[model samples]
Target: MLVALIALITTVLYFVGGALLMQRLKLTAAGEPPGSRGLPRLFTLWGAAIVLHAFVLYAFLFGENADSLGVFTVVSLTAWVIAAFLFAWSFRHPIHVLGIVLLPFAGVTVALDMALSGVGPATPMDPSLRAHTLLALIAFSLFTIAAIQAAVLAIQTHMLQNHRPGGLIRALPPLSLMDTLLFHIIGWGFIFLTAALATGLFVLEDIFAQHLLQKVVFALIAWVMFAVLLFGRFQFGWRGRKAAHWTLAGFVWLFIAYIGSRMILARLLGV
Candidate 1:
């Protein structure tokens, strides 16, 4: 019953989010205000969907008893809050393009939260450990979403650079601004990834034991890739195609660290 309920809400949010995004894209392409007639209503509806989705997961954690779900619940809540604030800020910064693109992705996450449910205390582990884990995961989540946005931005940037026309390219922000936003997001992500690794190490002793190693290794690899990317960007003036490729590579490692660790922890190691 709980699983189905959460899934239903998850699907609703995904569908609504897609509609809102498509509407926004259409408005932008038309050279009209992104906030057009009925658009505010759609945004408001999305807000409600977000709140509803959060509550459903919270219930899944508090009402039922699943540690893994609770871990996911806390992370999802954090993502919700961040996405909300970022979505609002996108108005001035225009970084919201990434946010809208990423919103529907959350639905996949929420569904996974339901599918991966197992028997345990909804609230798991010591408070300190929980805090570290959730913080790390949430940080990775934002950057992961941001990475996807950067990919789109890069494609848009490329098309404009080459004087290509049509498709979604016409609606995106200019190349310079996209590059600026890309760096901004990656810088923050690197910091968070570092802190996540540090805190994760502190939270768990013996890095090789249990699920720690996989998360740690992939996380470290992600951090290294970004570090190299940033270094190349600053030192060698690596921009455009190189930047996009490097960004995608870094995110690949991050995905493994995020979803991969969860699976190994939940299924393989039984952590």
Candidate 2:
């Protein structure tokens, strides 16, 4: 009952934050300068939501009978990390607009974890494996943010090209700034992904025996895709649509490598 209450409160806070952000964006679109009080309130609400969400995670992950890392739990953790990063980034960068999508998603994740009761297999992990998992989750969360940013960039580019650069485009940072932010996020994500893969190697005894071959292959493919994209950006000056497409494509493979493989193994193959 206590866990449920915490989850409920966290969910409400998340939705409230998202709604407030959306309204702020709308106000910006309508040429209204943001109220000085609004930003502080939004941050407070989001920070409170993140704290309560952490409590919910603790209850689910460390409470009695917590033997496995459930799918919903993993997703909730990812959402939590993403929200935290966004909150920190907002202090220096105008990326709080992302909360218009992410905060509500975090709310839904918390609710789902509560509703499903963390349903998953009982796979235990040692410290090394736990570290690997943590790195992977962080990398995935960063990629998730980059993917959203890329989508927004794609839309922003399209609107500008079509001479309809009003509304969301106005709400967003400038095109060059958005592009720079996306690559910055991708660069950090790529570094974490590299570390995750490296740590994964130490934790796995046999890839084939452990049924992690598919996961590894796809992850490496994603790594290569991002590597090429980064090289192209620095070496050949790739940006705009090309950069957005590559970001999305790389995230797809990374998604398949992590979430897709887990779902298949847990649900389809019962492995």
Error of 1 at 146 (Å): 2.4
Which prediction has the highest lDDT against the true structure?
2
lDDT by residue for model 2 over 1-271, one digit each (tens)? 9989999999999999999998888887798857554999999999999999999998877888465677778889999999999999989988888888999999999999899864765456678888998999999999999999999999999999999967688778899999999999999999999999999889999888787899999999999999999999999999999999999999999999988998788888777
Which whole-number lDDT from 0 to 100 does residue 220 have in model 1?
84
lDDT of 1 by residue, 123-237 (tens): 3457777678666766676576567766886778667778875446655667777777778778877887778777776677776654457777887888899999989988998
For model 2, the run of ten residues with the poorest summed lDDT: 117-126
Model 2 alpha-carbon miss at residue 256, Å: 1.1
Off-target runs (Cα >4 Å) in candidate 2 are 35-37
- Assess every candidate by TM-score: 0.82, 0.96
- Runs of candidate 1 with Cα error greater than 4 angstroms are 1-7, 26-37, 64-82, 119-123, 264-271
